[model samples]
Target: MSEMQSTRRGRPGYDQQGILAVAVAAFNEHGYDATSIGMLAERLGLSKSAIYHHFGSKDQILDLALDAALSGLEAVVDDPLPASAVEASAVARLEHVLRGAVHVLIAQLPAVTLLLRVRGNTEVERRALTRRRAFDRRITALVSEAQAEGALRADMDASVVARLTFGMINSIVEWYRPGGREGADRLADDVVAIALDGLRRR
Candidate 1:
């Protein structure tokens, strides 16, 4: 079967955002293997060919959807640290970046969740994993700085700390809702506080 025929949809037309919204929802609900282009087209009232026009194949669609989520994360990581060394300590800079990351994770939870779930079964997923590792490395560097500056506890390995930190941050995707008792800002504060100060109250 042709790529479109196998996927059961045409290139995506209409608003790219709208199409991505529908496609991501479909992928989330049905999973990558189960979702068909026909179903997506039916949902959007378009032909399978329409989606194919927008995306070359199912994998292409998945890559674009995943990118949409990771792009938000990339934005957070790309933010510049304070220009003056005295302006903020390493820990403060780390907190700022973490807070920005929380916004990205919460705002783009669906896409990010999908992005995190990739199993490396395809080339797209493998590429996603590489990018995810790079992001983690940058965070590790910040953690190392925090340790050197005495802002963060130095007992633990920076790589280990970075892994745990991101592990906690990424977990937000699993449980976060758009509106709840705590919003993104509040959640970010709570996360940073919990990280900086242990759960035990003095």
Candidate 2:
């Protein structure tokens, strides 16, 4: 038997990846629950059954779309930071990861946004959240190490500091435009300075 179809429309033989790409865009614009296979089919100029041919259900489509969104993040999480602690100062390493994260997040904004917005209402959403939390935990450990090394303030808890840092970076999704007044590098610089250094005139 052939693979299960997601909708009544059947399937499109070529470009399942293309179909998923369109689906991700639609899911981003309308939200996963709000979007439908019909909309995806219409957008792709395929029949609903065609979409079903590729995916077994709307949730299956979401799973694939979420996978696409999270692909970048997975790489970041997997890559080891600069090996020696001294060569890769905790703070410096954290900054490097954060900068890379900004690039990845911006480059994959739709998927990253979806990853950030997951609320655990479904299995896929819950898994995305778990992965996000894992990344956060890694950052938190870096912050704690930085604090121990006297690179960051020890007053605030590492977890709290990590959340604050992510809050600052994640907010970029709301206001950052691809070619706006502030570029990604400049924004990353400003963010690092504000987060790692104080504004007091020295």
Candidate 3:
């Protein structure tokens, strides 16, 4: 059968992406450990078999959902500065990463929220936590570099700065509604302003 026909045969109109989206929302609502295939199937209005048609197990779904959040963050960290920003200061590069992180968190709010809630109970959660630590290290390194360059304060620990900075950013998931008075750009601007204002050396 053709791809379209195969999709219909497998799960009617629901594809992996749609299924994953619903699954992630449920994961966020009920906790990953509490969410089961049966619950997901009920949420999707499909049978367990139909849910399995897209994903092999609920763990696989959790893996994918965590990846959705981690990949966006990894991309923000890995992406090189624009050509025009090649000569930018360490603080400037740090600011860019912060803005990118806010954008990612806003765009992938559900996945990010789920990621933040993981406690390494499963292999997938452990792996995500490892990647998250690596991301945090990169931020700390950047903060250190900025401090070394006399851009940010020298007295404060870089790791502390990184944690506190991300503490602010990660907290966005709690109250950041998409279509609220504050748009992503405005939020990014405000985050950068608030964060960098405190970090920037006098």
TM values, all candidates: 0.87, 0.83, 0.92
**Candidate 3: misplaced stretches above 4 Å?**
1-11, 199-202
Q: Return the lDDT, model 3, position 80.
A: 80
Best candidate according to lDDT = 3
Name the weakest run of 10 consecutive residues (lDDT summed) in model 1: 3-12
Q: lDDT order of candidates, best first?
A: 3, 1, 2
C-alpha RMSD by candidate, in order: 6.0, 5.6, 3.5
Off by over 4 Å in 1: 1-13, 81-87
Per-residue alpha-carbon lDDT of candidate 2 for residues 106-148, written as tens digits (9 for 90 to 100): 7877667777777899987888778778878988998999999
Tell me, by TM-score, which candidate is best: 3
**What is the per-residue lDDT of model 3 for residues 112-196, given as tens digits with 9 covering 90 to 100?**
9999998999898999999999999999999999999999989999999999999999999999998999988999998899887
Q: Candidate 1, residues 95-165: lDDT per residue as tens digits?
A: 88889989988888889888878889899999998888888888899899999988888999999998887
In order, the Cα lDDT scores of the candidates are 0.82, 0.78, 0.89
Say which prediction, candidate 1 or candidate 3, comes out ahead on TM-score. 3
| TM accuracy, model 1 | 0.87
Q: Residue 61 deviation, candidate 2, in Å?
A: 2.6
> After superposing candidate 2, which stretches have Cα over 4 Å from the reference?
1-14, 80-86, 199-201
